[model samples]
Target: MSPKKRFEFAFPDIGEGLAEGKVLELKVQPGQRVKQGQTLAIVETDKVVADIPSPRDGTLVSFGVKEGEIIEVGRTLAVLELEEPDSGGGEAGMEEERSLVGNLETATSAELPPSREGREAAPAGPPVTAGTTAPGLGQPVAASPVARKLAARQGIDLAAVHGTGPGGRVLRKDIAETAENGRPPAAGRVQPLSTLRRALASNMERSNAIPSAVIHELVPVEELVALRRALNEGRGGEGQVPRLSYLPFFLKFAGLALREYPLLNAAYHPQRQEVEQFGEVNLGVAVDTEEGLAVPVIRRADGLSLPQLQAEVDRLAAAARGRTLRLEELRGGTFTLTNYGAFAGLYARPLILPPQVAILGLGRIHEQPVARGGAWAAVPHLPLSLVFDHRVLDGVYAARFLRRFMDLAARPQELLLL
Candidate 1:
């Protein structure tokens, strides 16, 4: 008589040197038949939430970890009763198991193996709010990932938005209409901070420890505006440049300005008691997302052309807003740029983030009266602010860097030469 065949699926390494993650959702139950490559669960590690797939066709005998439990790599995730008996050739079976082990290590950022039915695999999208629902919370409402993200961003209640999808699932288009039609905002109430918000709070607390000083200036950007207008006219089409913002100009100018003032592109290590300067300019762009603030880095910003920089910025910003940035994209930034101009603020005292000694903020560009040719004329001016570690930089150097930066910004012709 043949023995019962069982296969234990362990939580494989999901890359990023992450050793542990919290199980967000369990799709299958005990005694349920699951096909190979079917999504079994969603796991979140270090802010990266990804869907975990079944390794083989089997009946889910039992779940090793309950939802909301943190699990480490190599820990058994589930025990499955195989649909087919194990072949008598032990060597071939072991080889097949080894291949499955490798497949388990893949992440949303990587090209995943094909699924059994070839469904369009959804990549790691928006973040799911963490922590278990309170007792009697009525079995957590179900919504599509896009719908959840849109609702969160628009601050609309998911329950209030009528779902038109199958089984009353809220669709993205419905959420958009709800946002545009001015749905009633939620009443003010104390609520728990989300996983991403908690992390940001901790980081800001750490950042507050640094002795920082802020300085501001108004950069005349008439030429910059004209240049952008000219470029857009030349394109002659909508969405020719996906996300053509003033950011790429700021990034390019900052990189050039950093070359002249390398001290601004440096970090300070308190324990080492030394300032480390970097030749390569890795710019961290602060992106405001539904999940809180995310700073995705642009490596070697000094080398990328204006168009390339625009593309990279658009890609990272999309990923960040969509909640798909990997761990590496969030770290190793030598300098930071925060563009509050996109929203509302006119000027802000940006804070220094961690080991990085400096942060630059670009505020809204406004038309103001200026003395030109002995006559008052309205011209566009960008509000600029720079915050730096007091221990590493003095006001004099900061003033000098700002002067050079503004000069580059004023002369768009020169900036393009770089």
Candidate 2:
């Protein structure tokens, strides 16, 4: 029998350009015997909350990261002690790695040397916590656990203080001195962006790269409003039929318009100089939640009946707000629709998401005075903002799409209802 080896499970690249995830929970602790495929920890990534599972059966030795710490891709997450077979077993059945999201790469005692001090060796590289960066350096700072705890308890950023201990590791005295020195107020200190904020910044930066154009229009929706109210009043109790919102009506209308003007429901591959258009309108509806803006896609938006559309919209909105939406629900959107009217915005200059050529923004519906048959009448008009990528289509094409959408919205009765 071979000596027991230590297995190091590093964080995996779970696709969708995930850089890091914040550990929401630790499911296992040292000395706990875990079976293969057991969940080790739960983490919050850019898109969803995920579980980091054990790749192979072993005894949990130590964790490279603690709960509430952020683990970057390629950094070790946990260490496990394993008994290896002498022959016919490839790296003690721990060579390959797998996770709930995707494949992962792991290292073991075969590649890494074990600690000579009679304890499990920690995974390579430091866990990149919230404030592990050095003052002027981008790398993680070397500090004792005691100092780290004291600094955190005192609300002192380790990166802003100079170390005085051996090997320049920040000590307890350094933290005490920094707190006693009275650093600048929180308003003036450097505030590192959270994981969600970082993802939003990256997306916004990419959005700014597209050559976008926005055109606004006001469409009368008195008839649509009356229809929605009647439908809502006639609906059954909870779990039978969902309450209707104007956004669902617009979602259906937008699908029809996208079918008529397929160019608007297309993706532009700039590197390949190609435009990929889809027959189905996979509409992405933007839902604002406490975490941030989440766009959940409704597959085949053009085919659903009014009730189905409303129910789906309600379900997706609820899931997004609760942060329980599946990965597939947040992907493969050919076009996006965002309703900012809930916030009382009349018209907004919404930005276009990358790859998708167009996005439709809906604004608050309000009464506008109009002249009808030599008489002044008030009509409810819904504001619309259509933003599109110039590289995929021009202003005229986008305007025509919006016109077709408004034509559908003009008569909501034409759409089939359950």
Candidate 3:
């Protein structure tokens, strides 16, 4: 053996405050040839499942960490022998130019070309640079380990599923949606909780430590509905203008209400046994993704207009699902909003995320019989659930906050002006 020379790629800071990640998969073995930017493994952090790509064209020597092993930042992931060995520049010099966490691009939907085997082919524009889908090319079908596992259990080949993720990457949602359409759910199966799921469970457990109270109310939203419809009509184009919905209205109303009742938008300092009220409103919007729930924050939401807020919400939601959200987008949320009503729920006693004293859940908007002009008439009503930390806010204060929110929600057009 001509002097053993190799390059070791260490895990870098994949996300803000992410100290480590669990190795969920390994895409190459010893002696296997991997192209630069090809996926080498799948790593799962608390926030999302991210693909780890090879830093250079090389032959894999060995992986430092095994599957399901938690590796901390700055730890070597793998060693590889470069195809073109440097004569003067040593391994240290070559490693300095490589990005360990690079090539992890977001998946975007593209028109699938004619199938080679009656299945949707990869994008037609050009060959994928990050991860390959063709056999003998590189890794086959870039997807999260969870997505691949689910596809295997369903007897569905990943290539057949349409990928809407960045660079035509297949996602867990794509697999789950395909499985639901092709085969019914099996009686049951035992699978380990993902990092995202485990993190959510732990957070929920922590939330239970806080004594919370939930207050339910029904707000008339006929005016809100009409306002939204009219606003959308003027600027209604798919993926163009921000789609107006009752959500933007609710968010605006909540922010305005928070200004008056600052207590509702505060974090509790348990160590000091006091409430810490924030000067700015950083609202967390709970988004459901294939991995799990991610709350991306809208920084200083109070300063944003209805249109601006709508666009930010849309961008954050897309980023959350695509696993492309940054660290700052995931933190510093003074308050939270979860819309269970979007799934046809009447109301849900939403849990208060620890430290944050309150969380508001929006129930389904539906037509119900309400007294109008002293007569029972069918009108659209919105169900609102306000859950607050009892230590920080009394029931009366919580009720008052809701009343202020409803006062703004009832006059939806007025909010549009703001």
Residue range 294-337, candidate 2, lDDT tens digits: 88899999888777888898899988776667666878899999
Q: All candidates' TM-scores? A: 0.69, 0.74, 0.68
Cα lDDT tens digits for candidate 3, 26-75: 76767998887677877778876666777668789998986556788778
lDDT of 1 by residue, 1-418 (tens): 4455677788877644456666655777689999977888767554556777887887999889876466777777888888676688577775566456644644334433311211244343333224323222433234455676677777887667765543344567778888788886765545445445655677788789999999989988999998888776646367565545789999988988888899999999999899999989999999987667888999999888878999999899988876677667877799999999989888898878888999999999999899989999999999999999999999999889989989989997996455
Q: Per-model C-alpha lDDT, please? A: 0.76, 0.75, 0.76
Q: Model 2: runs farther than 4 Å from truth?
A: 2-6, 66-68, 84-190, 236-240, 416-418
- Which residue pairs clash in candidate 2? none
> Best candidate, TM-score-wise?
2
Instruction: Give the least accurate 10-residue stretch of model 3, judged by summed lDDT.
Output: 109-118
Cα RMSD to native, each candidate?
Answer: 7.3, 9.3, 8.7
Sort all candidates by lDDT, best to worst: 1, 3, 2
Pairs that collide, model 1: none
Clashing pairs in 3: 106-166, 107-165, 107-166, 108-165, 108-166, 108-167, 341-363, 341-364
